[model samples]
Target: MGVWLVLAGLNGAMAIGFAAWGSHGVEGEAARWVGLGSQFQLLHAVALLALARFCAKRRRLFRPAAGLMVVGVALFSGSLYLKALGISLPIPMVTPLGGISLMASWLLLALAGWLACDHARV
Candidate 1:
C-alpha cells in the first residue's frame, strides 16, 4: 500500500512536470513526446492509486500492474520522447507491447472487481 501510494504520487508529479515542460519549455516534436509522456504518466498514476485503494488484497497481480504501468509509461512515452529528439530508436515499436500489458492489467482488475462483488453478494 505504501509503495503504491508513493508510486502514484511520484508518477503523478513526473507527469505534471513533463506536461509542463512539453507545453512551455519545449517546441516541435519534442513537445509531442512530452505531451504523450505526460498523458501516460497521469494514467499510470491513476492506476496505481486505484490498485492501492481497491485491489491491495490481491497483492499478487496488483503489484505487477503497478510495475507494468510504470514500464509502459517508460516504453510508450520514452519512445515518443526519443523520436521527438530526431533520434531513431527501435523502441517505439515496443509501445504496442506496453499497450497490451495495460490492457491485461485492466482486464485483471475488472476480474478482481467482479470476484469481489460476487463474494460480497454471497
Candidate 2:
C-alpha cells in the first residue's frame, strides 16, 4: 500500500509534467495524444490512491483492482506517450489490453463496494 501511494505520487507528477510539455512544447497530433495520456494517467493515479486507502481492509477485492488499474494506466498511457514521442514498438496490442484492464478494474471496484455494503449489513 505504501509502495502504491508512492507510485501514485510519482505518476501524478509525471502527468503534470507531460501535460505541461504537451501544452508548451508539442503541437498538433502529438500534443493531443500527450494531453490525453496525461489526463488518463492523472485520473488513474487518483484512483490508485483511493484504492490504496481501502485495500488493507478489503484485500480480496481492492488488491486486484489496484493491480489492474496500475497495469492499465501503465500500458494505456505508456503507449500513448510513446506514440506521441514518435516511438514505435513491435507490440501494438498492449494499448487495447490496457483499456480492457481499466474497464475490468472499474467492475472490481463496484463489486468491492457492493461487498462492503453487504458486510456492513451483517
Candidate 3:
C-alpha cells in the first residue's frame, strides 16, 4: 500500500508533465497521443491513490486490483507516450492489452466491493 501510494504520486506528476508537453510543446497527432495518455495516466493515478487507501482494509482483493491498475497504466499510457515521441514497441498489441488489463482491474475492484458487502451481511 505504501508503495502504491508513492507510485501513484509519481505517476500523477508525470501525467502532468505529459499534459504540459502535449499542450505546449507538441502538435498534430503527437499532441493527441500525449493528451490522451496524460488523461488516462492522471485519472488512474488518482484511482491508485484511492485504491491504495482501500487496500489497507481489503488487502485480499484491492491488492490485486492495484497491481492490475499499475500494469495497465504502464502499458497503455506508456505506449502512448512512446508513440508520441516516435518510439514503437516490437509488440503491436501492447496498447490493447493495457486497455484490457485496466478493464479487468475495474471488474476485480467491483467484485471485491460486492463480496465485502455480502460478507458484511453474513
Candidates sorted by lDDT, descending order? 3, 2, 1
What is each predicted model's overall lDDT from 0 to 1?
0.75, 0.89, 0.93
Candidate 3 displacement at residue 110 in angstroms = 0.4
Worst 10 residues of 3 by lDDT: 113-122
Model 2 deviation from native, Cα RMSD in Å: 2.0
Question: Of the pair 2 and 3, which is ahead by lDDT?
Answer: 3
Candidate 2 at 77: error in angstroms? 0.5
Estimated TM-score for each candidate: 0.79, 0.92, 0.94
Native RMSD of candidate 1 (Å): 2.6
Q: Taking the tens digit of each residue's C-alpha lDDT, what string does model 2 give over 1-122?
A: 79779878988999999999999988999999899989999999999899888886756989898889989989998898999889996986988988999999999999987876857557
Q: Rank all candidate structures by their TM-score, best first, as comma-separated numbers.
A: 3, 2, 1
Any idea how many clashes model 3 has? 0
lDDT of 3 by residue, 7-43 (tens): 8999999999999999998999999999999999999
Comparing candidate 2 with candidate 3, which one achieves the higher TM-score? Answer: 3
- True-structure lDDT of candidate 3: 0.93
